[model samples]
Target: MTGIDFALNHMAAPRLGLADFFALARSLGVSAVEIRNDIAGTAIADGTPPGDVERMADRAGLAIASINALALFDDWTAERAAQAGALIDYAAACGAGGIVLCPRNDAASAAASGDERAAALREALAALKPMLERAGIAGFVEPLGFAGCALRSKRAAVEAIRDVDGAKAFALVHDTFHHHLAGEGELFPEMTGLVHVSGVVDASIGADGLRDAHRVLVDAGDVLDTVGQVRALGAGGYRGPVSFEPFAPEVHRSPDIQAALRDSMAFISGGVARPAA
Candidate 1:
């Protein structure tokens, strides 16, 4: 079997600046990294020039995997179009391959009828398709599995992408945490463009109760079965980046983040290499 191609998301080390973040990724021998707009004082949020980000990644010999996300993407509005355009422009300028599209995850969106949600999803994707194609970038649609998430299944995202004939410019982000929360069975490796891997080790919280604060680096105690998900994706024909995206405050505050990351990497690598039972 092919070895896992590991990538790092800024969320894994959000405290680091762009240059330092790129350096950290390189230090871990990680070639690709995801940059996020949500992080305060970061390039995207601080209005740093895309050229500067590109130069830093180039100096560090790292690839910008994808801009972390365009939130509430299914609720396309005039403002959303502007935001998408700007993000796409920046991603192209930074030489990034794709931009992540996060669907609406709120009570109202969740309350929508299934048919209504599906139609809205298709509408937004159809509108974004040409824009992404024009920029020569892929839209990585991430389905959040929270109870309030409007898009909770990769199967639904795939269907929407197909309905809009967006396969050429769109793909799915198979987030292990979200997958576990959604209780989804299909991997859809063929439609997957990226994979976000994180683990929940807290034994007290039920799957429904798990939150981003509970996310931490994958370890032997991980309840999310991240290693199994990775192995399944690989065996099913995914040869894409598997990115570390722990969101726990503890992980972000680790004094020795590099060491912690290395340990998680080793643990995941070892697990992925083991023969499946």
Candidate 2:
């Protein structure tokens, strides 16, 4: 089988530098790496430009997978537009295939339900499509499963982007853990552009306080079904990275990061997509 492009999220290693990230990825059997600007030890989310992030990726010999799209990119105001434009420019420079657009976090104020927020986000996505197409990039729209996230499923995201001028302008980003949290019991990876694989081994913490910080990788009987979810993505015509995105405190603290990665890869390959018992 062809090796999938497994891009490591920078947040996986907290104290590691750009150089260290590259070395660790190469050593860990990863195919490529994605640099999340917000976690890259600087004020990137405040609108760090593409040139700076691109340079870092180039120096590391890591192909830029996708630039993480965050904040209120869907507000459609002048300020929001400017910020979105800056992020597009940054994605282009990093040689990313696309920029990932996450929908807004729900609020107690005027934001309304996820559906309403998604509507506004759809309009904003339509506006941004032109820019992404102009730059020869696609937009990767990710639906956060947390109660606060407006769009929480690939089905919802696909529907929103369905009527846009550039319908192919973007695709869904699926994370196994998020899918479970949202109770997305099945897999439909045809709409997906990226597959972020991180295991949630901890059975503690109520869902409200849960963050991305506890992600690990696949193993037997994993609650998130990381391996099966990844295999499902492959089955659904997404031949992209099954990237590791551990935001776990332990994964970062472990001294032998390489060994952990190796085991993770082995487990993923040997165990993906077993029929449910």
Candidate 3:
């Protein structure tokens, strides 16, 4: 079955309290949740604890799909590693399956490209392997597929994971948005760890535009051809949770987040039920 994980993007719903979000998730038939660390009221809501974020998830009876990501690993100074380690520890406490590591558009974008930068990312993750192992969480590497974006494909991300010797500690989040932006034709369905789905109104509103903000519902669009994507997942033998990561301002504007998410689930199941095998 295709499960849609609702994202708590602060920009989308500034007023939606975390408890309200839990109710919304239950109403929307979502058993899984992926919280954005950047959002208000979240654990580490502001580089600090938001208090009982994990307890809240427990109360909601939800499984943490994943953390959107911990950005900027290229500047792997000892101090920075300590800071990143804190986030990892929090993710473990929150019962998150993994933490997404986005190498592109990171705070350390200035150092996100070139072999040195890539190697630094590898080094950083390697340095954190012990801590991550102790925490028992996987590091999910997500590639941002855009021209100006530093990291735009799973290939480099895969290499980074390999270099970190993180086969056990790391996995991949294959976002369809990034997949299209990267113009990626290569398939590593077997390599796919987690998959994110969202649609854009205009193709031009792609990598350069509002980005995750433009993530609309999977209504009518080329991206909604998720059946092929799901088939690809099956072919790749990916059994991970597929998240409905819509970052649109309009979605949050909806008086009811539940209905919108249920619609998304229907679209996914409808699309994926088609045979591609």
Candidate 4:
């Protein structure tokens, strides 16, 4: 197997400032990063202008790969449209490569008719395509594997993109944790724009019970098979950044985030040479 390329997601160290976050990414030998607008008191949350973020990343010699996400994207309300426009503007101004679009996840969202959900998805993509193209950014659609998520299948996202003529403006986010939870074996490398990697090591929890809180850095105990998943994506022709997105509070609270990250990188990279049996 070839070497795995890695990128850093700000969720790993939400407490850091913009400059510090970029520096941490550089220190970890990761040249690309994904920042978030959701964390309170942070750069985006604190009203740091888009140009400032671009300048900060430039000074640090880092690439602002993508904005962490635009949530409830599948719902596609007027409010969501407004929010998407604003985020796309910021992404263009900040020189970020793209925007992550997360599907609506709730019991109500899951209960909607399949046809209704498909129609909404098509409408949203058709509406979002021009904005993304004008801004020169790709929309990275992430399908959550949880039962309550409105969009749970990459195949479904691809089909919707085709229906809306969004093949060029949108791509899929093949998230390892979600893939495991979804029990999906397919890897759509051609349509994948990014890959999110995380691990769940709790031996007692079943896939149905898994939640974002269970996500932690990949390690020896990882039950989600992060190594094999990454290898498969790479072998299947994916060459994008494998960004870390550990939602577990413990990872954020780590006293030495850099060290912990280094360890995970080593573990993941080592797996390339010893492909899982």
lDDT of 3: 0.68
Candidate 3 off by > 4 Å:
1-14, 41-51, 106-113, 203-210, 222-224
* Among all candidates shown, the one with the greatest TM-score: 1
| Highest lDDT against the true fold, candidate | 1
User: lDDT tens string, model 1, 59-137?
Assistant: 9999999999999999989999999999999999999999999999898897899998998899899999999999999
Winner of 1 and 2 under TM-score: 1
Tens digit per residue, CA lDDT, model 3, 179-239: 8777776657667767787777675554455366777767656553555666577666777
lDDT of 2 at 45: 44
Candidate 4 ranges with C-alpha deviation above 4 Å: none
lDDT of 4 by residue, 1-277 (tens): 4766689999999999878899999999988999999989888878999999999999988888899889998788899999999999999999999999999888788889999888888888999999999999999999999988888889999999998889999999999999999888888999999999999999899999999999999999999998898888888888889999999999999999999999999999998668569
Per-residue lDDT of 131 in model 4: 94
Name the Cα RMSD for model 4.
1.0
RMSD for all candidates, in order, please: 0.7, 2.8, 3.2, 1.0
Put the candidates in TM-score order, highest first.
Answer: 1, 4, 2, 3
Ten consecutive residues with minimal summed lDDT in candidate 1? 1-10
